[model samples]
Target: MEPNDQPAPLLEGRFEGRNDFIQLVRDALGVAAQAGWRELILSDSNFYDWPLGERAVIDSLNAWARGGRQLTLLAKSYDEVVRRHPRFVAWRATWGHIIQCRACPNADALDVPSMIWSSDWVMQRLDPVRSVGVAGTEAGRRVAARELLREWIENKSAPGFASTTLGL
Candidate 1:
């Protein structure tokens, strides 16, 4: 069945606390899939707190996967991710063809804003430690968010987090 155009639900908020932020991340993914956002981008330091390993998150990602869709993830290091998020690693391996995973190493030590960016929406943890930030669909927010991360995604980051490691 063709997916309906009806959006999932509004998820915009200025969230505080870890649980609230996690809920926003989860809700945003569901909305992103439902709305059929074409490009999904996530930038984080290490993704220590994201729910990427959860089954529900994977389900939403599956729904969102299709031709012409692209997903990108930027991080400083994936060591913590590898240690903490096995499910997401598996998912990434399977979906590697559709994902672009990159790293900011060395002097590119930008304080990568922890955020989720879709074609029409944005959610960022402005103070990640406090789990406090904003999520919205306004054009200004979307544009500013895009501009803030586009440079790193395009120029500063290097290929990272291999979908499948090879050794012999």
Candidate 2:
């Protein structure tokens, strides 16, 4: 099936604490992979360090990419992420064709929380200061987040992975 470009209304809920956030992201990734989702979009500064630091998460992501899934990451601190998260860096290196990353210079000023979108599902950390976040299959919210991600990618200059020498 082709990816849906239409916006869907967002259904929202909250996750409190690091464990809850990690499980939410893990479950969402599994669902997306099982459903053969074509596109996965993530915007975060340090997601590779906290919740997604596990080896299983990295392996799952690699498997999904190997299955022809496409991933776009709009990261705020790409450099730091690579330095701290070797697993993620290695995964990106191995699946550079399926995964593409862009750096958002205005991420801090935007104060956007980390978000993951797959198919119709979305999980977002609404507050940066707290571990609280909202996750749901609300179509509208997913579309809004996707649009914001698109805007960030378009407006910022691409930090070519080649220049970073991360081999991504």
For every candidate in turn, the CA RMSD to the true structure comes to 1.9, 5.6
TM-scores for every candidate against the unseen true structure: 0.92, 0.80
Candidate 2 Cα lDDT to native: 0.69
Decoy 1 TM-score against native: 0.92
> Model 2, range 1-168, lDDT digits (tens) per residue?
236543233335878777777677776666565566789987776555354546877866765775667888877767666667677777777788777777756557336448887767888887645658888877887788877777777776365343226454
Best by lDDT: 1
Task: Report the number of clashing residue pairs per model.
Answer: 0, 9
Model 1 segments more than 4 A misplaced: 1-5, 107-110
Worst 10 residues of 1 by lDDT: 1-10
